[model samples]
Target: MYEDGEYGRGLVPYLSDAMMNIGTKVTYQTVIYPSASDDWILAELYKLKTMQTRVFVVHALPDLASRLFKKVNEVGMMDEGYVWFITEGLTSQLHNLDHKEDLMQGVIGVKSFIRNSGKLFDFKKRWKREFRSLYPDDDETQLDTSGIRLYDTVFGLAMALEKTQKEKGDSAMDSEGTRALKGGSMLLQSIRNFRFDGLSGDFNICHGQLQSSAYEIVNIIGTGEKTIGFWSPKNGILKMLDNETKGIKPVMWPGDSPVIPKGWEIPVSNKNMLRVGVRIGGFDQFIDADIDPETHQVTMTGFCVDVFKAVVDALPYALKFEFVRFVSSDDKRPAGTFDDLVFNLSIGGYDAVVGDITILAYRSDRVAFTLPYTEAGVSLVVPIKDERKSAWIFLKPLEKELWITTGAFFIYTGLVVWVIEHRVNKEFRGAPHKQVGMLLYNSFSTLVYSHSKCLCTLLHIILSHMLFVWFIIC
Candidate 1:
């Protein structure tokens, strides 16, 4: 809806609440056209043309609405895929205005319902005759729904006054000698409880307000309008009065087409291109923007650029965008930091920012950010010294505990060998020192594979083979 000062701006909240009750989400963007200048209207219309929303609910004075419709038609917005809905203020006055058929061809509007009856037909004939006599030159003037409603209001008031006069005297004087209605409150109560089948359908006043039975849904076709449907509180939108079906009749939309519009589209015009801001002198691996000297066309590349392009490609509709180098306003060069870029975005400098921007809490408060495409963390690195300078460097290959464990295993193997071989194989006789020396020789010789003594028993041979395998492993 266009946010004019008088009507459209004030109805936004009520319209939002009504739509919300019906489970529909509505986002209102206000385009203010404060003056009647053509340039101001055209400028606001251009902004609307770039937006994705095609459905509009207009609530403005008849003069402003007429101007808006004429400009909209000139810009080709009255073509297919656009839907225009006007409220009762403009709809009730449409019958008296002689607007162009093409300008209002596919527009839809709602006004108070006036049921067809012999009494209503006769009233229209009398109204036309009287209006013609009063202003003969104004042939376009006709009785509208507002006139019918006014007639009902006047008739109901007259009936209430007549009942008031019967109950009490016509006038009562106060201490100041000023006359007033004898039963003022009684008259108000009578008016509030009044109900009658008037020219404008059923006129029932509830809670001191006139209750509408239904609203006529009209579509502008040729020079006049066609009743496409009716919207009642009990049954919602209905194609016919007799049926319970909940839908409008098929309408001949703008461009003379019968196909239903999708009600939204991505703007592809060059003037409506989406401006994407890129960080200018950042780390080149993440984002880089270059400008040609001759043609002045910007070329954006790097990891961040590829990611942004992929995201756009995944959308169901085509999005036209151009990458702009984000520069400082003072120097016209790259901005100092990401915070500066985000602040500019919040103030309407760019439509979107694409780069390696960190998701800080302060930055998030300014502009929305996408899910972080890279992992979040920090890493520490230390340098290693040369090992060739130390004589004990060989011990660095294994821990000190591993070296001690290896030596203990070697001594244990020597003892096991001596215990098994001493029973039979030791040349069958030997001194204590000689046996001890022989044990040392047998155990240590396995490491160099220089043992010449042969095993006489199977147990000794098995121990010797096990020691040999351990030697090879070491």
Candidate 2:
């Protein structure tokens, strides 16, 4: 056995038999703790420190013999940092006592530990000085896995059987025969090229991992349980220590797959999701028609939704929004668009403005606007020359001084009314809504004031007509 990889006191046979008592296997069945990461082991204890699993129960022992006897865990030892038994409840845990200052409570093991009564076990080697010997050139903290691969005994057996079968059929077991297979080094590639099942997953691997020897776990740990969803191929990646949050950063692994704990979700940062909202059911100016919702998002012909996809792709991140809305003219179908830029924004409309939005700014303070994604062509409106000349003069721009005078007059009158309300009615200054109402009422009433009530009423009615202004503009 190579140094740390050797089986210490595991020569005893009766101990292995005792472990089968706690956990029996069907087809060598045992639940693996997903990973053998030191952090992985400690973490499993947290949610189940008071509870117990075959793996957890085995890890609780003191002496190597005891732990070996309890070999009920479906996982391999993760460099043996801490072992604990729960017969003493959740307390009386074990760890590298040199780093762990509190050894007064539980029995400390320099090389090995055997409980006073309950069958607890200790470690194969003393960690306090053993670490110094393991890494003579560098500190223990600098230790890294230069070559590692997470192994699956089940997969190994399957591969061995496959080799055995292929050799029997044609006596081809070496790479020479491997090269004869159509697709390259990858078993997935070979499977796709040929029609034979070897390993990895069912139906021959195509997209993901292959059965190349380049991917192999250095360790073959056995227990009685099957772990799922975790089997990292040995590739270069950073890693962490046994659940230690302090002074730790990403460490690279060269060969074996690092074990991840079962049931622990991988942590991920809150990434932005691409969002896009369309003016669904709004006026579509392209073909000049409103969208009808009774039709599915696809067109009335059941072909496509609005050309919103095209427009959204053309838009910047501005296309994202909490709500999804799209607009399409009844005459035209949705235009498909594509983008490669990372988009993290959204789009949508505010409070029920079900009308049209032309090239004019709506509420100035409501939203921010970018330079137009598109441009409109210039338009010219010829000035009508009134032959009489008087009406045309008013339509032309006024003199600078005349404009200033009229603006000042409006400002002065407004200030006077404001001051009066502020002084005479404290409540007006506090709220001022009533004062504003009165000012508007008085100004309009004075605009159409007349000696005859009938004429005043008629003039007021005619001036307030919105259609009158519309007609004049037209």
Candidate 3:
């Protein structure tokens, strides 16, 4: 499911084509629901239930995903049989969104693997401090993954420009002034070949795009998430890092089950409804096997029955089913173990048994089982204690070193302008009051590009050079 937006629509073909090239046929339905509305999600889910498409690739914004998953959880649709795969767009922004973690439990996300490094951590600390200082009132001030990409992008452009600037010699502006920065093409080529260790990871450009093959597979559990595995174009999905031989990490799936879901069980193309042998007693909530006196046919209805019917309806093809009541010989109740009930399926007494059947090691010999809807696992729950919490959290958006660096640069700019402009202008030839004011104005005006009309030409020249420096800094 993708958002009903132009960008979302544009991405569909790329994804579809990629899958099709690998001989995988793709069929999809687009959903356009009101933002953050559970009612709209439920309506769409109802349709999905009838079509029996167990796996869903959701390409939506984080806000929409939160609402959709909340509805999915409410309707009991986030079971083992269901799968939700989010694209990079939603996955990258998820960590910065509000209460989104709780809504995306058990979801699998594909993201460009951002390796941790000292430089990256330092950048993050600076970003956090600067962001808070700049926007003290804003609650959501975290730097997103895209911001790091943007940083690398700007750094790449600057490096490229610096190289081109040197090769083209001092002033790139031609006599006509139209050839300013004449190496635009050369700069682009330089950027395309740029390589460096960036904050995110290795920043190698190949085929006009970043050359990274590693992707992290994250599983959202509780109010947080973790990396359960990794996927590389070269090695496919692996339980751990390719170099690490450690076993796969435990996955806390939806509904708190550690059991990894088998994507799908029964194929949807088959036409026949499975002959389901339902146990009649013990617990009626799972399935209640009853007989219709008038039709003399076995009938079943309850939680398990509803779930079975829902899954069958969700299938791509039509299915026909007949419920057969399991009558134990010699008594109304089953005379033997639950294995006896499952044995009927093996002997052709029934094609499948849909009820509260205990899954065990021995049961595997008789018949295959779909993913269990019920959750069973042990989990370690811990309370998070943030000792760093303080009233001065607003200062967290920029690092102290960055703040100091910015202040030092501001002072340096004022000193440089005084040295250059003091000899060239009458404004610099004044008393201490006017001289200091002029110096401060020259340094600060770069931010607002403001100056008196008398000094426009001089300021323009200075501002032009300042603009280039500002661009690199930004």
Candidate 4:
């Protein structure tokens, strides 16, 4: 973690509490540097890279984050699996970061939700117009959320002061420049309860803190950021406005990959590689670990080993690890069961165990397991037969029950039409072929509104008369 002193005070504790509540053991390291100290920032980034910390939670001014990321990108470490999570302080300044967009690409940040309303849009338009007219030479003069919030706070305080003066009568005049207000506590209380709609949405306060409607999860794309989702205290993470909607827009992740990142991996600080335990008994084809006689180095290669390496590499951090053969000193036979290898992790014999280890309830109680990457239980592999070809493939999208229900609805509609119009209608009283065609047309037309010219005229008259009767009844 790298941040300036002022912003770090509030942000650090909140992030620490969040991590602790989720049972994550974090090794917190803080780097305090001035906002414009390039040398200091470069040194810190090098230290972080050495520590193998791929995910950095940056709590600083927007300029500092831009400088730090520029240095990081220059080092060629800004590719896949690196993550930078920033606080609202930096995100609010995104408009001014047009020049540093490449440095900040793939960054994730949080901001207070500001709904797009007509009133808000109008305010933005006027603000921009006035800004352009006043400072025509300045390129970065856009209003941000913080500025709006500050504007609201000043107005709220003014209203509270006015109310306090009315309640305190003439005594409020004496406290204007004499240390504090005569009813300052009362004025503060009034401000806390103030509620109204402002340019940034609902201007409200609760328990001396501004109530946040939601936290927008933004992803930095090209030159600006896009809202990929939102997190509300009431509804948790949502892709859309609410739970009923599809989701937020898709995000372009690091390296332009569309997949969501797995946020962590083993650290490779201190030039220490991970001590991996691999079993070599029952599943030789899945995994095989042995010592190279010529090189005297441990050699491990198999399906399971390949999968483990891929997972480690896919983590949003850099990790250095080497597989160690989990066998007895005798260099013969096998060790114990899969349970023994897992127990080794607890006993400090290995940092992690990788093999055909089945995740059972008993094993889970002893050690934690990640989400399984492969299918469990048995799978039968069958040969493909190229004998059959049919036109029924078009119906495969619908389920069997759905097809039956649809056919039943069509038949029922035809029967009901025949019964209703067969007696008096000339269209229904026809030859066998003509009767079938008329019945099919009537059945399908009921699904869609279609009718002959004569029937259409009669239906329009009936609808108009019904509407007239309904209007009179109302």
Task: Work out the TM-score per prediction.
Answer: 0.56, 0.16, 0.55, 0.60
TM-score of 3: 0.55
lDDT of 1 by residue, 365-453 (tens): 88999988868788789888988888997667777887787777667666676776777675523898877776666666665663446
Worst window of 10 by summed lDDT in candidate 1: 169-178
* Candidate 2, 1-474: lDDT as tens digits: 000122222322343566667673211211223224444444443433222121222222234323322222323332222232222111122221122222211111111011122211111124335667877886454111110111223344356456544645444335565635332234443333332322222222334443432211111112111111111224321122223233222211111224322311211232433443333333344323334678644322111223444554554222232233333455254222211010111123232221233423434234443334357577799998666668576645667886676556445444444454445444345446776764454333433443132223433454445234434433
lDDT of each: 0.78, 0.32, 0.74, 0.74
Q: What local lDDT does model 1 show for residue 397?
A: 73
Report the C-alpha displacement of residue 116, candidate 3, in angstroms: 1.1
Per residue, candidate 4 scores C-alpha lDDT tens digits across 1-474 of 656586677668777889889875566566666645777767766666665456677777766666777787876556776777888888888776646567878888898888788987887788899888988898847778898788778878888888998998888766565645677788888988889887777888988888877888999988778889988877777888667454566777666777766655454456677888888877787898667889977678788889888887776456678777777788675577788888887778998888878989988887888878667688899998653465676665678887676667656666666665667577788798887887677655653454442233444454345345434533
Q: Superpose all Cα atoms of candidate 3 onto the true structure and report the RMSD in Å to 1 decimal.
A: 39.6
Which residues of candidate 1, in runs, are more than 4 Å off?
A: 2-10, 29-35, 171-179, 269-474
Give the range where candidate 3 is weakest over 10 consecutive residues by summed lDDT.
450-459
Model 3 lDDT tens row, 309-363: 9998786544678876676675377645578888878788898788878778888
> Which consecutive 10 residues in model 2 have the weakest lDDT in total?
337-346
- The true-structure Cα RMSD of candidate 1 reads 11.7
Full ranking by TM-score: 4, 1, 3, 2
* Better candidate by lDDT, 1 or 3: 1
Off by over 4 Å in 3: 21-25, 33-38, 174-179, 242-248, 262-474
RMSD of each: 11.7, 29.2, 39.6, 22.0
> What is the Å distance of residue 184 in model 4 from its true position?
1.9
Regions of candidate 2 where Cα sits further than 4 Å from its true position? 1-363, 370-474
